[model samples]
Target chain A: MDYGTTPLHGLPSRVTICEVGPRDGLQNEQAVLPVEVKAEFVARLVDAGHTLIETTSFVPAKWIPQLADAEELLDAITLAPGVRYPVLVPNERGLERALAAGVRDIAVFGSVTETFARRNLNRTVDESLAMFTPVVARAREAGLGVRGYLSMCFGDPWEGEVPVERVVEVATRMMALGCTQLSLGDTIGVATPGRVVAVLDALAAAGIPVDAIAVHFHDTYGQALANTFTALGHGVTTIDASAGGLGGCPYAGSATGNLATEDLLWHLHGLGIETGIDLQKMVDTSIWLAAKLGRPSPSRAVTALGDPLPR
Target chain B: MDYGTTPLHGLPSRVTICEVGPRDGLQNEQAVLPVEVKAEFVARLVDAGHTLIETTSFVPAKWIPQLADAEELLDAITLAPGVRYPVLVPNERGLERALAAGVRDIAVFGSVTETFARRNLNRTVDESLAMFTPVVARAREAGLGVRGYLSMCFGDPWEGEVPVERVVEVATRMMALGCTQLSLGDTIGVATPGRVVAVLDALAAAGIPVDAIAVHFHDTYGQALANTFTALGHGVTTIDASAGGLGGCPYAGSATGNLATEDLLWHLHGLGIETGIDLQKMVDTSIWLAAKLGRPSPSRAVTALGDPLPR
Candidate 1:
């Protein structure tokens, strides 16, 4: 009854959320929780009704020690029958380590911006895509779901504005490599709603359906929810979020949190879109996670639902 | 040049920002800065290209100790010709004080929820409206700008959902009382974009032009920016924001902060709407204010631009 008298329009009937807190979220955090604790966090998220939970990354321990216990964490947590636990794989070696651990879902990341690809992934755009080709081929042969993450699709701190045509080019190639899904990331949070609309349109023109696209926005400039609104208007239904709006870009020193899962859910549920995710349970998990990190959740919904000061 | 290749549609070319930090923002803060510092804060806001600033409140000292020096602050600050400083006056007594101080603009507060009016204002809605009638009349007689603020226009903590019809009725009365503008406040931050669109339409149907309306939203649920985008689509160009998201409600203890001025500027400028507000100068004022309060600004733009940690 509290849904208000207004009829909603131009949004999806349901949404699929991919929780990236365990991998992308924690990897940026300075404090590393124990592997057992990480497993517990994953189990709690699954309990919160998230079907696609990104549990860990297969990168070397030296690169992201926070998620270094990927194998241990994967073995320790319970994976529900309907749930998907995708781990980030940088290359064939990372993919091998993940396959050896019985991971059936994995994602490769590259930047649409050339500078980000070189500085972060140590390759040019062509080189990074080339490196991912064999990895995706192998994953498809193994009957696993492959996803591609395109970072800095909108703007980059160093490379400046990236053209939408360039993003479409990279995304189409990733799809051609047998990727089932591609997430467009506004890594620096400089995206506006109009730019999101343009990029989505351009990608559509490049033969990628809106359903194949997921939006990933950082909340550094507080444009994530608005940008998400724009994406929904374009019929893009999948979104990537971190619990507690976790994750800071180490590359961009001033970037803060991601678009929080709780914040995103609050708006989605309010719009009468079924995400199949429990709001209270997600809030509990975020509160628990923030406690482990010795900070309050930087999420408006979490704060609105409870006290914000850290215990 | 970075406004993107897609031209915006259904949005205004120019927007008027009503800076609410000094009044609505600082009123909730516990640490009271000296009157001199408050005066300097107003002057800095004027320098930041804000044409309208809610500088202080005329509420009694016992009620709001933080702004007890409203008179001294008004006298101390230099008033720029192009800028307007509006003071919040609760009733006849507050209005008399403001008039004696040579104030040119004042705002009276009411609520769409009767419970908020009865409990907080200690009067029923009818009694409060009756109380504001003479105040607005005298202010108009003195040729001063009179604005009306209606809180809990969306929903209330105790009253649940507020009907859009009720908001329209109360707002129409206020406008008839000679108030130039009526700002609808989502005091609890529960409104979605659809609800905002409906409410704005209802107000318009009631003969209140969208131009005579301003929107005020709490970022309690991270919906402020998204709701703002909806307002912009409806041609409601005036918005209320707190610098550094400085305000919190003592009644709604879980409520976090107001929508930050810097955060709003980031997207509005990105959307190519001219607000005349200087982003860097607003950041500087927020930084200075946060330092004086000995806390970090809870603003994403502040964090994205630089660290807001205590000095």
Candidate 2:
């Protein structure tokens, strides 16, 4: 509806939204959909103009039953031209599965703090990075782009406020593992804008160009969009968002969903930045998925723009 | 819980949050609480360390039956020392009512667009301003502080994209009537960070000091916090918020609640900015109010921190 535009300096004219709804989002959701539905979800995101979609995770089904049909879902969906579907591969086994499935882009998740590393990865920070090394190395050898996810960059529920220097050190180590992009995760959604800027500044000082960094924020504290805005001001062009704000942190029970793609698009577009996303189409997709899950979408944009659901 | 703090440059170390829950928030709610409950709400807000609270509106009960007990509610609440209770006064008669009730601070509501002025104030923009002129004048004459509220400063449902210059002109005129503070309201909640910057810049160019301005944003499109952050960066220290995200625009059907005070506190305190309000106390008050209203608070911070209610 032409929500007015006023351009800000120092912001990129265009941004790439990394759609994580299919993989990260579904992995955390309780309702397990059919493989066909998962495939359709990926297709709808592609239709909504998402070029980079995390299609699914190859983690063991025992750990995440919601994405148990990763291979079947990947096979069921038609691969669109010029779109990149990145799958999460935890270790060597998941990498082999992704390789067999013809995945071209893959992501390996790590943690910045020892507590989260032990809790989420069943290892210390060093052990998790050691685990990701082989997966990232083998994927890079296969000519596949690797994205490193460094979680708990802001605040860890168990560890409290994470040190900025520690984040920079871990982020550097992860980026050195043949990763093309590093997405800093606010796993607990506890980051404010200044902390976001501090982390980005530290990364830049460590020689990590803004172009190679992406921000992944959770809206648990309603600071995701503002954090994303701060990241954009620092010249980070890629944002990791779940369509419909689908994912909640499994490790931190209080964490809400990722920054909603619809909400992010509203801000990006309203600032005269190009996202190439159809906001209405994305909102409609969230509504459609919400119905499938028998729940309303957590996205504020979806709630404000979509029709009222029947009681 | 200490959310990590990293101070940003050029932001005020402390900000004044104007609590608008009792007046703006409750006026939009469907359930009409008794005058005693309304009084308790104000008392709770003062206890949570809000120095400026909009206690009630002296508008006719026929217009807003939800706030029919404005005088009684004010009478029931004990005013805390060093706290300011500002009541909304529409015109001469409303000012008389507020004065009779011993109100030391009064606010006059105006519009930045013609349609909203006609629809909400039942007059044109000029007519509305003319009506507020006498009210603001009398309030100032009586040695009471006068606040001017300019709504639809960002966008309007009927008249889309209100011009920046128009907002500046109306705001200048409103402030000229001896308003100690002028609040820019994004009533429809369509503002983004850039638009916020644009309006604030225009106002500054027109000789309006940042200290004399406040921002009132709605979370309808999930832009309020981001917009608020942008406003803070522009040196705005006064933020208008409703506890528990309580208000929705009566004129804009799809509009969501105001920026929740708890959510705003999370961002402000996380940035190392002080608000003097206890976060836990505010969340508790919102939880208590939500229970009385038979609904959960829309605040993300409250939802994340407060225990989940049984379905």
Candidate 3:
């Protein structure tokens, strides 16, 4: 073995990938695949050894009609015994719907930017967080796993440069209020490797454990992987990625999509890190869905692997 | 600074970027830009703070007709002071042509995989390296800088998993011949962060200094940035990138272009590395060139920064 070729230090040994395709990816799609197709996609991801699958969002139908079938999709999908299936909940109502659908894991979202919060959720940051408090309390009482999302943690379209102090405050508050994990989202794809480190450094000063932190970055700026490395260097273990690089953040103007799961796995697996995901199968599912949706996958990895089913 | 939210460990503080758009990007293009356009592109890249620009190839017109104007473009473009503009020279004939054109820096090409060499250059590995030895010797005598490129340093379509020993022998021989830099080219874009670390480790064990190494990876797998980080961890300082994510390796099946310069800068700059390149300006140039080529830039960073140009 060429010891010279292997990295001597600062390489992540294992990375926990949180596949957000089912929620973040499918939610933005205009052509909704049937609920069964959605379930099949999630199952395929599970079969590929993805441990954390964000199945669907329980947002009001009026808000995002595309994910109106979230309950049915969650109920219909076969749950792999060890896999964690989480659903997105906007408020107490959304959490009620998710709990009724037998969701054991729930995620609550809030925006660090005030403009994005008002535009996306029709509530101010304070209002949104206030609304989510009950939902988090209920979920904890119901013995459900809850993850808190601080969207636009780095920068926002309406308000650029989300203050690190504000992000830390919001994250600390969320985690203090029954949330087990806090993912800082770079909604507009503006986070650079430097800024990621800066933000992580700030969070570290606040005494947050590296293992509890997750990063959600968009590929819009094409810095997603680089940002991931910044997070990894900070010892962040959980990374959020979408399958096939699907799903555009509606609030993020001109942003393309999230980093693709296949691409993410390729890097993690290549580093000798244990991601526990199969690359070839994930490529197959992305191709299947891209064909059904009649849109090319935004993932270069999927394209390079070839559209296993050539139309 | 709300330092409590930051994760600690594994992040890079700075990064190195090598711009290859003018050479690797333009060579694979079908609709060749005029010599003036090429010259302008180089000037703009220099203005954008690109320190290392691979300007063009001295290969025969029959091979890559797109870059036949290499000499004219080099002559027309004003070489920014302190910028190292390197051109690819396949053998003695190519080197002679480049030398006559007043080229001060040249890169010699070889392949790690036997089949790829035969298919790409119509020469066997030994035959190709044998051809480069004389060119390397002549260039050394001329007091010009010489760099050796080992293509398919990662995986190859014709022959997969290029052995570290093969790469080591080729790289060691090139270094012995007085080459200042050895660029490991992932022609097929299949390298993961692990593979990158593995390859770099192998080379280091072979007694190669990390500072003398450069990496050229394709975004075919969307792991270029990730791989770059791994390389940085091993102390590899130079990196090869294409402007606007311009071109794919024609011979490497499914290989996309080098990682985009704008994207690379985003990551590097983020890592607190002083690349001295302006992000907004870089994106503007990429968008301008993408229009000139009558295609959307393959650079997601350019697209994400969308229309930074004043309307």
Best by DockQ: 2
> What fraction of native interface contacts does model 3 preserve?
0.50
Please state the error at residue B215 of candidate 2 in Å: 0.3
Q: Per-residue lDDT of A1-311 in model 2, one digit per residue for the tens?
A: 56568999989999999999998898888898998788888888888899999999999989888988989988898999999999999999999999999999999989999988998889999999899889999999999999999999999887788999999999999988889999999988999999998999999999998889999999998999999999999899999999999998787878889999999999999999998889989999999999888889988888988966321
**Stretches > 4 Å off in candidate 3:** A1-14, A201-207, A307-311, B1-16, B308-311
Give candidate 1 misplaced runs (Cα > 4 Å).
A1-7, A308-311, B1-7, B308-311
Estimate candidate 3's alpha-carbon lDDT, on a 0 to 1 scale.
Answer: 0.82
Error of 2 at B193 (Å): 1.2
Q: Residue-wise lDDT of candidate 1 within B188-266, one digit each (tens)?
A: 7888887898899899888899889999988988999999988998989899999999996766555667899999998
Note the residue pairs that clash in candidate 1.
Answer: none
Cα error, residue B20 of model 1, in Å, equals 0.5
**TM-score per candidate:** 0.96, 0.98, 0.91
Cα lDDT of model 3 by residue, A1-311, tens digit: 01112332576778889999988998888787898898889889989989999988888888888889987887798778999999999888888888888889999888887888888888988888889888999999999989898988887776666778888888888877888888889877877765788778888899777777899988986878878976886789899999999997876566679989888876766666778888889999999999888998989889887644221
DockQ of each: 0.49, 0.57, 0.40
Model 2 chain B: weakest 10-residue lDDT segment is B302-311
Better of 2 and 3 by TM-score: 2
Cα lDDT for residue B190, model 3? Answer: 76
lDDT of 3 by residue, B87-164 (tens): 999888899898888888999888888988899879988888778888999999999898888898887776666777
Q: After superposition, how far is residue B51 of candidate 2 from its true place, in Å?
A: 0.5
